[model samples]
Each structure stands twice: as C-alpha cells, then as structure tokens.
Target: MPRFALLLAAGLLACAAQAQATSFVMTTDALAGASVGVSESTSDLSSSFGDDKIVLAARDDAASFVASDGAIRGARLEAALRHIRERAPQLDADDRQLARAILVL
Candidate 1:
C-alpha cells in the first residue's frame, strides 16, 4: 500500500509539471487565423499548422510567439530581431524600427 501511494504521488506530480510547462492559445481574424503556444520550458515557440505543431527554441535573451496554423517563418524572422533588441543594445534606431515592424505584422 505504501508503494502504491508513492506511485500515485509521483504520477500526480508529473501531471502537474506537464500542465505547468505547456501553454497555448488560438486566435482568428477575418483575414487569417493563428494558433500559438510556449514550449514545455516557456522559453521557446510552439506553432501549430493545421494538425502539426513545431517547436523552436529561442536564445537566452529572446522570447517566441507562435502564430496560428504553423505560420512560423514570419514569426521566427521577427523573433530574431527581438532577440537583437533584447540582447544587443548597440543596435541603432533603424534596426529597432525594423524589428518592431516585423513583430507588428
């Protein structure tokens, strides 16, 4: 009985950890739709395309946002810029502006 209780406690802990690690959401608009999530670490981007989701790890100074339906190409490009902004303060205003535009889209 003690062993069984230990197993049950371990299982519950695993389930709770899994839940805390993964987060996702769906968004839709008249023009397009997107589904986005953070990976198990919340440090990477997880994008779903139709039924498929891709996980992309980000740099230490970066944050990732996955768009609906696995539209990751654009999002990744934008993420790169954001990374620069967060990690490389030497970047000029022009660079920051460009990154902002990519993120806004």
Candidate 2:
C-alpha cells in the first residue's frame, strides 16, 4: 500500500511539473462529461462548449463540414482545435488523439 501511494504521488508530481499553467484530472472517455470535475483551467472546456454557442460533434461529420466552408455557422475545424488547446493549455498529444474525432470550441 505504501509503495502504491508513493508511486501515485510521484506520478502526480510529474504531471504537475509538466503543465505548470494549471492542473486537471481529465477523463479518458470519448466525450468527457461535466459533472466529474476538472482543474479550473480545463473546467472551462466542460462549460464553455456547452454554455456558449460552441458545438461539439464527432469527426464522422468533420470532413463534410470542412468541405462545406460555411456549414455549422462557419465554424472551421481549425478554430475548434485552437479553441480547445487555448482554453485547455494542459492538453497533451495523447489528448489530441482522443480529440481527433471530436470538434469542440
């Protein structure tokens, strides 16, 4: 038990050191929900995308939207990715993988 605790602490320390801007406990699910909670920095993603006019959808429709140019209120794919990365500065490459199939702003 003590060894497990030590390892967990070490892992947390590493994450903290990596993204010093803000901390978060993000979900690994395809579409992370709002209730579980995250660091204040990432917390905005859970709220802004839902609260604001931002629309989040699966990449299954992205190719078509990208082709349309003005589809979905002219919300370009690049804008969505930029929005997420900007608001959630702690996002990593792996998170990008999970986000590849989703558009969020």
Candidate 3:
C-alpha cells in the first residue's frame, strides 16, 4: 500500500509539472500572436474603412450608436448604408458587421 501511494503521488506531480509547462508555452504563444494581430488588424481596418467617405462620415455616429445601451438607433446605420449604396454600391456588408467595422475604425 505504501509503495502504491508513493507511485501515485509521483504520477500526480509529473502530471502537474507537465500541465504547468504546457500552459506556459500556450500563454507565451497566445501573447505573441495577440501582439502581432493588434497591429495587423489596425492596418487592415484602416485600409478597409479609413479611406471611405461614407464610412468616415459615419464614424462618429457609429461611435455614438454603439455607446448607447441596448435598443439600436437605426437612423445613423441607415444613413451610412444609404450613402454606401448610392456611392459604392458594389460593397456588400450587413448592418451588424458594418457597425462593428465602424467601431473598430
């Protein structure tokens, strides 16, 4: 019984050590990827939304729209969509996605 208990404890310690090592590696990799993603996403968002007149016009309104609690105010969204449809009708996007992109910009 004593020998069995000793082996079990040894096994548990080894597993715990392995878990800690694995978590450290995962955390390190996640941090590295997140840092790289931040810059890339910013640049991507800029290229996608920054140059657009309609999106630029809607940035402040979108910021305000998101700042408001639940119950979306669609006026700003509609206005932006209208402008997009009138000017660059080729671009396709849904309201939620456009709102998110506006927030990101």
lDDT of each: 0.37, 0.48, 0.66
lDDT of 3 by residue, 1-105 (tens): 999999999999999999999999999999888556445544555675577776777776766665674246566666875765565454455554455566676
lDDT of 1 by residue, 32-64 (tens): 331112121112211111111111223221212
C-alpha TM-score for every candidate = 0.24, 0.30, 0.41
RMSD of each: 15.5, 14.0, 6.1
Clashes of 3: 0
Better of 1 and 3 by TM-score: 3
Off by over 4 Å in 1: 24-105
Q: Which candidate order results from sorting by TM-score in descending order? A: 3, 2, 1
Native-to-model Cα distance after best TM-score fit, residue 19 in candidate 1, in Å: 0.4
Cα lDDT tens digits for candidate 2, 17-83: 8776443433334236532333332345556555533336434344555355435423444565666
Off by more than 4 A, model 2? 1-52, 55-75, 94-105
